[model samples]
Target: MSLKELLKKKETAIVAQWFDRVVNTYQLDTSRFLKSQKDAFANPVGNTLLQGLKAVFDETTDRMDNETVISFLDPIIRIRALQDFSASKAVGFVFFLKEIIREQTAKETQGNAALQAEMLLFESKIDELALTAFDIYMQCREKVYEIKANEVRNRTFTAFHRAGLVADWEEEPRH
Candidate 1:
C-alpha cells in the first residue's frame, strides 16, 4: 500500500500520539490535566491542539496548502506563544508529527522501498508545515509584544495627563 493509504489507516493512532507528545511539553500537573480533560470548555488548549493536529495531518497527507495549514496552526501556536515557552518550544509541537508518523508506519514501510521514498516526501511536507507553524508563532509573538507596548504607552500617557504634563492634541489652539 502507498504511504498515503498507510497514513490514512493509522491516522487516529498517529494523531493521538502526536497529541500526547504535545501535551507532554507542559508541566506534569498541567500535562495530566490537559490529557485527562475532554471537555472543550474546560480544556480549550487540549481541544484546539488535538483538532489542529488532526487537521494538519489531513492537510499534510493531502493538499498541504500553506494558508489552510496556518489556519489550523494559529490557535495552537497562539496559545503557546502566550505561555512561557521559548520560540523553539512553542513551535516544536509540529515536529512531533514527524516522529509519530515514523513510529506508526515503521513496520509497514520497513522493507518497501517505494513506501519509504513516499514517506520521505511526506516528511518533507511536514518540514514545510513546521516552517509555516514557525511563521505563525513569530507573528503571534509580535502581536503579543505590540499589545504590551501599547498598554505601557497608554498607561504612560494616562499618568502624564493626570499630572498635567501632557495634553490632548484637541486641547491645543487651532494652528
Candidate 2:
C-alpha cells in the first residue's frame, strides 16, 4: 500500500498520538485537563485543538492546497499566540505531526524505497504547514499587540480629557 493509504489506515492512532504530543506541551495539570475534559464549552482550547489537528491531518494526507490547510491551522495557532508561548512554541505543534507520522509508519517504510520517497514528500508538506502556521501565529500576535496599543491610547486620552489637558475640538460654524 502507498504511504497515503497507510496513513489513512492509521489516521485514528496517528491523530491520537499527535494530540497527546500537542497537549503535553502544556503544564502537567493543564495537559491532564485538556486530555480528560471532552466538553466543548468547558474545554474550548482542547476542543479547538483536537478539531484543528484532525482537519489539518486530513488535509495534509489528501494533499490539499496551502490555503485550505491554513484554514484548519488558524484557530490552533491563534489560541497559542494568545498564550504565554514564544513564536516557535506557538507554531511548534505542526512539527509534532511529523514525528508522530514517522513513528507510526517507520516499520512499513523501512527498506521500502517507494514508501520512503512518499514519506519524504509527506514530510515536506508538513514543513510547509509549519511555515504557514508560524506566519499565522505572527499575524495573531500582531493583532493582539494592536488591540493593546489601542487600549492604552484610549486610556491616555481619557485621562488627559479628565485632567482638562485635552479637549474635543468644536466645529467652527460656516457662513
Candidate 3:
C-alpha cells in the first residue's frame, strides 16, 4: 500500500498514540484527568491535541501547507507554553510524529523504492512541521513574557511615578 494510504488507514491509532504520548508529558494528575475525560469542554487540552493531530495529518498527507500546519499546532503549543513546559517540551510533539509514522510504515517501506521515497517525503514534511512548531512555541513564550512584564509594570507604575522615579510630561509650577 502507498504511504498516504497506510497513514490514512492507521490515522486513528496514530492519533490516539500521539495523544497518549503528549499527555504523558504532563503531571500525573493532569495526565490522568485528561485521559479520562473525553469531553472537549472538560478536557480541552486533550481535545485540542487530538484535533490538531488529525488536522495536521490530513493536511500533510494531502497538500502539506506550512501555514495550515502552524495554525493547527497553535492551540497545542499555546497550552503547553501556559503549562510551564520548556520550549523543547512544548514543540517536541512534532518529532514524536516521526516516530509514530516510522513505526507504522517501516515494514511496508523496507524493500519498495516508491514507498521509501514517499516515506522520505513524509519525514521531510514532519521536519517542516517541527520548524513551524518551534516558531509557534517561541511566539507563545514571547506572549507569556509580555503578559508578565505588563503585570509587573502595572503593579509598580504608581509607586515609581509617586517617587519621581519616572519622568513627568507636564512642567511643574514655580513655588
The candidate that achieves the highest lDDT relative to the unseen native structure: 2
Clashes of each: 0, 0, 0
Q: Predict model 1's lDDT versus the native.
A: 0.90
User: Ten-residue segment with the worst summed lDDT in candidate 3?
Assistant: 166-175
Stretches off by above 4 angstroms in model 3 are: 155-175
Lowest lDDT 10-mer window, candidate 2? 166-175
How large is the C-alpha RMSD of every model relative to the true structure?
2.5, 3.0, 3.2
CA error at residue 146 for candidate 1, angstroms: 0.6
> Per-residue alpha-carbon lDDT of model 1 for 1-175, expressed as tens digits?
8888888999999999999989999999999999899999999998999889999889999888888888899999999998989989999888888888888888998899999899889888988888888889889989989999999999998899899998678899887
Q: Better model by lDDT, 1 or 2?
A: 2
Residue pairs whose backbone atoms clash in candidate 2 = none
**Residue 131 of model 1: what lDDT?**
87
Give the C-alpha lDDT of model 2.
Answer: 0.91
| Cα lDDT for residue 152, candidate 3 | 94
lDDT tens per residue, model 3, 40-90: 998898889888888988888888877788888999998988876778888
C-alpha lDDT of all candidate models, in order: 0.90, 0.91, 0.86
